[model samples]
Target: MSDLKRLLKSSGIYFLGTALNKLLAFFMLPFYTKYLSPSDYGEYDLSLVYVNFFIGIFFIDIYVAIMKFLLDDSYKSIKNYKEKIIFAGFVVFVICLVFYVFGFYIFLTIFDVKFAILLIFLGVITYIHTIYGYICRAYNFSYVFVFSGLFSALIGAILTLIFLIYFKFGYVSLIYSSIISTIFAILIIDFNVKIFSKFRLGFGDFSFVKPMFFYSLPLVSLAFSYWFAEFYGKFCISKSISLAQNGYYAIALKFSALLLLFVQCFKMAWQEVNFSKILDKNMMSDYYTKAINEYIKFLFLGSSFLIIAIKIIFPYLIDIKYYEAFIYIPFCILIYVFIGIYEFLTNIINKINYNKYLPKICIIYLVINVFFITFFIDKIGIWAVIFGFILEYIVACLMIMFLIKKEFIIKIKFINILYFLLFLTTSYICYNLNFKFIFLNLVFLLVFVAFNYRNIFKKVNLFNR
Candidate 1:
């Protein structure tokens, strides 16, 4: 089978899974707003900053190493690293537990009593949930993978509903809901997939530790930098404006996250297929060019479609108080578009023996992000953060260009860049017109396809064979 065919097959399954999962979470927004005040959500969002930050640090991103070590036939000769992976997860949990014990006050300031407990629960569960997902994908348990995601989301949404509506628990409802739902998810996956059966607690020569550490440790800094770059906007917002305004920003951010659902589904399947035969460098290089070109084309067109759809429909779904959130959606979507591009560029970076450039790239992103938030946010409001994110992504792409200059150039159709520019101009116009472009958006969509008719046909032709 062709690489495109395999990607299609895997993506189709994952698309269904992610769509159902994210759709459920999206619908929960109405239920949440009906019960909780903006202040409640602001505090909840604040607590999550610490939760996600600390978890990113100590969670260690070790699960990715499972794919790194095991997917290739080359690693089949070496003893499987399953036990070592489990041991590493235990080490991560212990580290997080210690951090909380000594520095509990750091959390006590931002987190309420219940929120503090929620953070610690999240710290431990990160490793478990991540490792489980990676294992299922590695073993080609596609149904199990999809089921596990849907189950977690469904259980969490249902629990949150009961707490907020029937129990009337307020913001703490989220805390209660997440902790209970994740527990059920862990139990269900363990029961069905038997992930724990493969794990035994022994050092076993400690071979996997050294290589995996070198591979993953650099990623921790990148992860931390990513969090700082992202959270800096919220921090600036809370300081310069008000918590309620930050809450609105968070809602916009959350809505933007739906786009990632598609990106992640594609990524999950892409990683499995991409790595398995990636040692054949020539074919991999050709595949990289073709895949990235299509990815870019899809990104612009899909984002344009979302812009129109959201303008016409999303306003009615959200409360009138949040109707201003419509303006933020376009910028929010741009952030993830750049992130999706970065993920694609990693195809080149992943092959290099040293990852020194990766951290350097992240540092550049962090500096730009901070400077923009500090200087521009107070003057221009939330637009600064949005522009900052776009600039950072541009810098990131430029850095990728420099790295690949000495090695290889991943050529993409330049017309796609033109399409992206056109979409950006149209989106800005639509936003300024207060989304009165119902007829215009339709005409633009039709014109867009007419302009790219050959490319669209070419995309379909890839799968015909």
Candidate 2:
């Protein structure tokens, strides 16, 4: 198959898998509302952010190195596969376990008893799943990659129902579901590919560990900092306002999961294309430039075309107490928009092996978000959280672009500005229940589609066949 065909096929599978995963989570929200109070859910959300950081700490992010090494054909040919993977995996596990054990004591003292245990146990299982999952994809086990997603989501959703509705598990239903689901997922992947059997008695190629650590060390640091920057808004809301308000903000962001899921599918395909076709770096760089511009154009135009009254719809599915969450949805969309752009831009840095610069970029995001959310949150309310993320993504994207300017040009398409304007107006009108403005929004969306459909279709045909 041609590159275009392979990309489209992989992206299509990935999109369906990701959408199903998000749908399962979305479907569980209403059930969670029936069982857990908003304040209880708020604590879960806060704990989730904290757990994410711990997750990063526990993994050392060696999954990144796993996939990168596997994708490089030349490297894979030279290295003894069984020896390299085993050596790398054992070293990573030992280091992370030492850190986890030491930090477990600190967590118990600082956090709630149940939360601390959940964080440590859940982080371990999740990190294991992540590493195996990346290897599955990097080896072109796309079926395994996609099926594992669907299987995990299905099992998670079922367990969530059984725990919350039947067993009355409350906030811990999520913890129960995650632990069970990840186990099932690992089993499925192991059935298809015996990732663990790659282990040998001794290290045949301990040399792989040095380079892997060098590459992944930066990612580990960036992971912690990037996570802090990403979750700072929720931390601010929880600190500056009530936990109930933080729950509202968290729910508002969940509504943007649709956009995020869509972006995630593209991320999978885009990264694979870059890694697999590493030899054709020059051509792929140009492809990335166009891909990102088209990405922004599509999202902005699609945002204008959306038709959903989240405020009205949410009350029916969730508690009426969170009706105010709808107001925050539009702003949340912008946060995800910038985040998606920054995510796509990072592919450039990864390709060029400019890993050191990644930490500096993440620091800018960390400081920008942490500073604004900490000081201004009390004064400006939830808008402070929104504004901080917008600024963080804007700064991060610009810095990434500036750093890579000497090597490649990433054009911000002219149509993107027009789409952005339409996006703002349409989202406002949709939120406010203004029919006339909604009609106008549809008209402009139609115009955008009409004008750009031909060019967009052409650009996606990477093989020119």
TM-score of each: 0.89, 0.91
Q: lDDT tens digits, residues 171-244, model 2?
A: 88888899989989988987887676664533556767787888878777667765676567776777778788
- Model 2, position 226: C-alpha lDDT score: 59
Among all windows of 10 consecutive residues in model 2, the one with the lowest summed lDDT is 303-312
lDDT by residue (tens digit), candidate 1, 81-149: 555565554454455567654464465565444557566666567557777778778878888778877
RMSD (CA, angstroms), candidate 2: 2.8
Each prediction's Cα lDDT score? 0.71, 0.75
Q: What residue runs in model 1 are displaced by over 4 Å at the alpha carbon?
A: 80-114, 201-205, 279-285, 429-440, 443-465
Please give the TM-score that candidate 2 achieves against the real structure.
0.91
How many residue pairs clash in each candidate at the backbone level? Answer: 0, 0
